[model samples]
Target: MIDMDRKLGRWRLRVWGLVINLVANAIALFGIVAVVEGGSPALLIIGATLTVVCVAALAIPPRSDS
Candidate 1:
């Protein structure tokens, strides 16, 4: 039973990490395009901030068993 829960928790973390990676990549691409098009610096800053958050999230491990 505990093993099953641990497996499920690991799966959840993997999925969340994938999502964060996707979002971070998309935001980075958009920021690059925006910069080329003379868009606001604020957008680029926000994208960078989000990327940092994603990286941090990926670095953190999931919670242990209750």
Candidate 2:
């Protein structure tokens, strides 16, 4: 049972990491495109918000399963 919990926790971390990576990549891509294509204010705002979220995700420590 403890082993299963550890495995599950690892899996969850992997999934969360993947999700964060994908979101960050998507935001960066959009920012690049927006710069090259003369992006609007809305796109800029969205990009800023996503950047904050990504920063927060990295800054906050995850809770341990213990």
Each candidate: what lDDT?
0.67, 0.58
- Residue-wise lDDT of candidate 2 within 24-64, one digit each (tens)? 66776777788789876565566567766655555555446
TM-score of each: 0.59, 0.44
Total clashing pairs for each candidate: 0, 0
Residue pairs in clash, model 1: none
- Give the top-scoring candidate (lDDT): 1
After the best TM-score superposition of candidate 2, give how far the Cα of residue 30 lies from its true spot, in angstroms.
1.7
- Inter-residue clash pairs, candidate 2: none
TM-score of 1: 0.59
Off by over 4 Å in 2: 1-14, 63-65
lDDT tens readout by residue for model 1, 4-57: 223345476556666777887787788889899998666677778888876766
